[model samples]
Every structure is written in C-alpha cells, then in structure tokens.
Target: MRGLFLLTLALMVPGGVQATLPPPPGGPTPAPRLVSFAPPPSVVVCKGGEARVVESAPIHARIWQPWIPPVIGRAAHQIPPPPAPPTADIYTFSIDADGAVIDLSRPMAPTMWPGDEQAAALAKWRFAPGAPIKGCRLDLAPTTVALS
Candidate 1:
C-alpha cells in the first residue's frame, strides 16, 4: 500500500510540533522587557537667564526681564517740573548660578528721572539655573492713578 502510505506521510510532517505549542492563552511567561537609553533631559540656558527641564530639575527663570519699561519716564519731561505724586520703582536683585547680576539694589522713592538707565539695564541681566531668589523684587509696572 505504497509502503504504508509513505509511513503515514513521515509522521504527519510537522517536525517539533511547534515546540509543544501551549502558550497562546496569555497566562504566564512574559517578564523580560526593559529598555532605557537615558539622555532625554536638556534645556539649559542658565548663563544669565533661561532654563527649562521640569520633571528632571533645572527649572529656573527662563529669560527674566526682557522689556520691563512700561514707562520709566523722561523720554521728554524737560522744563515741566512741580506736580509730582505718582511713583513706582522697586528693583531688587540676586540671580546667580550662571545668570550673573547678584545682589543688585534699587529702593526707589524720590524720582526726578534718574535710574541710571534703569540701573544699567538691570546690569545686563541674564538668567537661568534658578531657585536662588534671596530678595528678587522687580516691580515697576503699576501706574494707573486717576483718583480725580
């Protein structure tokens, strides 16, 4: 009978039987998958101001004080003195760690238009690498007094 049907087709041809085939119902045997290459946190602009890296640190003031002169005054106030009342200018500083300008002071009160060019443009401000605000107060944008 054709040599017993070629020995039952060589034992039904499927060699290893798919290695005992039994892992398809998803039950147990899946614990070998861990991959992490690192290097994914970098937003450093801390040479005077600018930083970002929230979940992994380095979240300092990213570019503090770009144009804080809503109106400092004296663009043209020549020969019109005597009627002063409105005033504001409280510049204080302390930003180090790369963003320079440390321990700057400016407790304004008596104005005749002389902030030394706004303290020399905040001493060439620059910021980054934060968390070191010892007395950082630069409030000079509040002049809406019309109580008449």
Candidate 2:
C-alpha cells in the first residue's frame, strides 16, 4: 500500500509520469486491455504485449457524504435546501509492468473531487501484465459522497 501511495503521489506530481491518451492519428496507438463489459475507451500503451484485468478493485465512494440534517423548527418551512452535488472529473490511471497502478490524473479539467483516496483505491487494481506490455489505462469518475 505504501508503494501504491508513493506511486499515486508520483502520478500527481507534474511531469513525473509517462502515459498519454490517444494522440492524433499516425502515431502508435494504445491497445485495448481486453474485452470489457463496459465501453473501454482507453488502452494499454505496450509494445506487442497483451494485458488482461486479473482483478478489478471496487472503488467505493459515498454518493452523499457528511449529510447535515436540518435543524427542526416548529415553523415547518425550515427544511434546509438539499446539499448541492459536488463537481466531478474523469481520472485516468496507468498500470505498470507489475500490474500496479503507477499513475493517476485528471485528463480533463481540474475538478473538486480530488484523486487522493480514489488513487489509493485505484492502486489496488490488478492486471495480468504479460509480455511486459507498456501498460493499460483505467478511467474513473467519482460521485459526490454523502452520509446515509
């Protein structure tokens, strides 16, 4: 886990990681990791190596967290307005040759949902890194967490 945390930290550091989304055509394209039940938009950027998801770590985020109950008022119209939804972003992670998540970042614009715990959880994703494939990608979107 420490390794994963360090790796996640490294990924957050600017210019510390090496993995690209699909570039303009004519360049070596990243290969899909495998046949996915969900649409796999990203791929592993390996050299003739194939990787399969040995195990997918479950990413748990409370959809509505820290719910603050409204104070009771006899007026009966004091129900606090519902909490607004938190902003979200798409985080793309890269798996290393060892199948551990080595890099994580928001390919899109910066978002409120910081990728800290998300990184730790994503780090646990296990992959079958055969033939030393350059590695594959996993994109995630975190929902606003709330206390039940």
Candidate with best TM-score: 2
Candidate 2, position 102, lDDT: 62
Please give the distance, in angstroms, between residue 62's alpha carbon in candidate 1 and its true position after superposition.
30
* Candidate 2, residue 131: lDDT: 38
Q: Write the per-residue lDDT of candidate 1 for residues 109-148, one digit (tens) a residue.
A: 4343445655666666665555654456654443322222
Per-residue lDDT tens digits of candidate 2, residues 31-83?
A: 22211113232343433544566766555543333243434332334544444
Give me the candidate number with maximum lDDT: 2
Clashing pairs in model 1?
A: 48-99, 48-126, 48-127, 49-126, 49-127, 49-128, 50-127
Instruction: Give residue 104's error in model 2 in angstroms.
Output: 2.6
What local lDDT score does residue 5 receive in model 1, on the 0 to 100 scale? 100
Relative to the true structure, how large is the alpha-carbon lDDT of every model?
0.45, 0.49
